[model samples]
Target: MLPPRTYVFFGLNAVRILGIISMLLVFASSIFVLVHDVQAVNRFMAEASESDMQDCDYIPGSTVPNQPAGVFWAVVNRLLIIFQVIILILSEVGWPLAFFDRFFPVLGSAFGLGALGIFQALIGAAILSHHVDDFTLVTAFFLFAIGCLNMLLGLIFREGAKARRSITNWRAQAKSVLPSAEDFRPAFVRPNSSFVPSMFKSGAGEERAEKSGFGFGRQGEKAAGLKGFLISKPLESLPRYAPPPRSEGSRSNSPEPQFKSSKYAI
Candidate 1:
């Protein structure tokens, strides 16, 4: 069976999803209302009689009335435009803020939604009073739906803190059971040490090189050659290659002495 925390997490997610869906529907419906309003206004202007046109307030290049009722529809259009802008800003800003501070976004969205509900209620009342048309009544209904969904989502966000905490604890426990990076290393293998070349000399040879001022035979020769090349000097100008000087007691001309064991002499 799934854990309680898992259920809670999913429930919260579902609420948030519903909230998003409702808001999107509201946005689409509002756009439809705006378009319908524009078409209605144009139709009214086209069908208006010559006497009615004179009674209507004149807008440049159009005979649409601007005085009493025209101004009201114009105001509604502006309000819908502002509402769209607010919805866009809230969605863009509030969602990311929710990731950091959950409570604030929840409260803010709730407040905004409540305000939308009130606005829609007023529009619905206007429609009932014959101040606005049936299209606005439909828009009002969409706004009310969006407002309810947003409020429900806000309530879920506010109450889901305990669920969030449980989920976080579950994650930490899961992490504890997993292997760490260090555990991935091979247990039987040792780390490699810095490399020492096979040609490296020790003891007497090392001391001899140190005493001669050159670090090593091959390295000194190579360094000198490279230095000559870098300085633009000809190969002939380089020092003549000479054998390393031998100690007086250990001359190369002396043959190594051989020892004879008496028991093996036969």
Candidate 2:
């Protein structure tokens, strides 16, 4: 998870500052290399052999190895600067333009810095391989260092931005899923209508009665007297259980008691 807004603001400002510094470095180095390449090209053209000219008639010949690579990097650096400035400006300005970051983070500082880092590394490697002058050597070293820094910053920024987006998306989803005030309205009330049903009138009267107290007002009196108006009626009683009458055939099936007569028996 990313830190809170207070830290995020500071973090973004720091990233922007670092990005600007990287852009400046790239611009200055690219300009230096480009100027040097141009001068070298002029010198090469001036001292070129007739056979060298014949071999390459379209473009000027250069004795410098990987001369094209220098010019190519110069162009690439210029483009990188342009994009970096745009990303930084858009990020700082906020709101409408900030939407650019929201919609396309790939075009944002994270991706821009990452691309610049990768490009700088490539340029440093090219400089190391092709030419080794004191100025170029120092430039390459700085570029390599700056490139690594940019890459690290890019990664941190990307993860932070991802977390931020996720938080926003979560809040939006939660808001959408939650029940609104309209959802809690009484069942008798229609969603599209302003009219409340008469069923709620009794409830409103009860509320008023409670506020005024039982004997304070006519409404309170009515509320209190409602129970008196409701009379209690006695419930009908259930029948008691009884045995069924015996049939003659059933009586005949039963054995009779035998009586013995004794003298003076009553």
Candidate 3:
């Protein structure tokens, strides 16, 4: 049943470490991939494909149409998008709680939905027929990566749900093992209040020698005292089913372990 809450704690830690390692790698990879090739970094930055170059065209005297830079921009945007998604998901789900519980999984699901939207668009569009291999590979990688992350989030939520079910079952069993509220409740006191000595004062106030009915506290005290304070009654004097007293002397002389107790009245 999800191996208890302790296992969940371990799962959380593992998820955090995994996220940290992944985030650093993804961030570095995103930045490193920003350049098209070795030449782009070494030479292109100095030239003016930089967009800082004024647009110009020689259609006689027409304004220059902006030239599409290269697939490098596409790759850069995709990388940035992926890195952003990773950072967001890890921050929302993979932090303090791993095996992310309810909230993060929901957020991850929303991200998955967004990814699905892109997947749909990629599947429908055909702008890169000449570079079919390139477009297909990039699209497939994005979909696969997003799907895997979404699936991991689902697993975390599934485990949390399992843990919840087990707790419910434990509560059901524990209710049966536990003593009921009524069992520990003393009849001499208020329904939930502490034992009050005044409950025992009634028997002592009878006008006649002993005509009044026995008070609840007197009966309880006498019964408890027989076990704890007067366990030395002779066999003939004991109740029919009474077992032999474990102690035969006053409590002060008893060899049995005694709990030292002090009472406070409020």
Candidate 4:
């Protein structure tokens, strides 16, 4: 699997960089509006030859007359005031989001983007509608939001690519570890006892006498004392190399000695 630490650190840094950029844009745009507001007031005060009424704070003080903007400059000045407030709000959010983003960087980035995109796009659309030709300084905010969105997408794709490679490598390793089918074979588990004389009896009690040392019957005489398959010549008996196998009914005791009788009529 992909290393978790590398993936998370890289993804987090991407979000942090985006946040810093957002904050920078906020500061830059705010300063531009503040300077523009001062310049407009100075030009008006210089032409009218009156005392200064505007404050040097973030936004220009609200109009004392409480009337709609009359001249083009008046409209431009009020728009600048709105832009200043937005910049302060954005800057407040950006740096704080960056700090909190380490735990859930992706989610934090999405949250930041949501706020940034809506406000910047709204302002951009408004500027375009007004045909304001000198909004270059404030345009940084729009670009920054768009840039953050791209960075977030890039991080997502990078993690996905790493994960896919890890899976492929795992499957390849498993294939190497598994045993092959060609090495398998079954076993033989039973004894070979097919050579008994009864097997050649042909479904009867009589067995065909043959010179192959297998016999079960003779003419009409029956050797009654102790009958067994006998050999005509000892050399034609069972092979000499084979071990003597005891018969099923035979015992280990010695056989009785044979008795001899004198030739006399009783």
The model with the greatest lDDT is 2
Off by over 4 Å in 4: 1-12, 48-116, 123-135, 138-266
Those runs of model 3 whose alpha carbons end farther than 4 Å from true positions after fitting are 1-3, 36-67, 75-79, 82-86, 89-105, 108-266
lDDT of 3 by residue, 1-266 (tens): 66564564455445444544444444444444343233343443466564444443211111112245543454555465565546454543435334333555543322323332233234223212222234334543444454454356445554343233244444664567674455654556566554555433444455432444345566755755765855444455778799776555565586778776768633
| Model 2 C-alpha lDDT per residue in residues 159-195, reported as the tens digit of each score | 4543343334446645785644446665556666545
Q: Candidate 3 local accuracy as lDDT?
A: 0.43
lDDT of 2 at 165: 35
Clashes of 1: 0
Candidate 2 stretches greater than 4 Å from native: 1-16, 51-104, 109-129, 132-140, 153-158, 161-266
Better of 2 and 3 by lDDT: 2
Clashes of 2: 0
User: Candidate 4 has which clashing residue pairs, if any?
Assistant: none
Cα TM-score per model:
0.39, 0.38, 0.30, 0.30
**Sort order, lDDT high to low:** 2, 1, 4, 3
* lDDT, residue 176, candidate 2: 82
Model 1 residue 216 CA deviation in Å? 36
lDDT of 4 by residue, 56-159 (tens): 22123322121333334554654574664355344424445554356545434334334434444444443334323244334654544554564454445543
Candidate 4: global Cα-lDDT?
A: 0.45
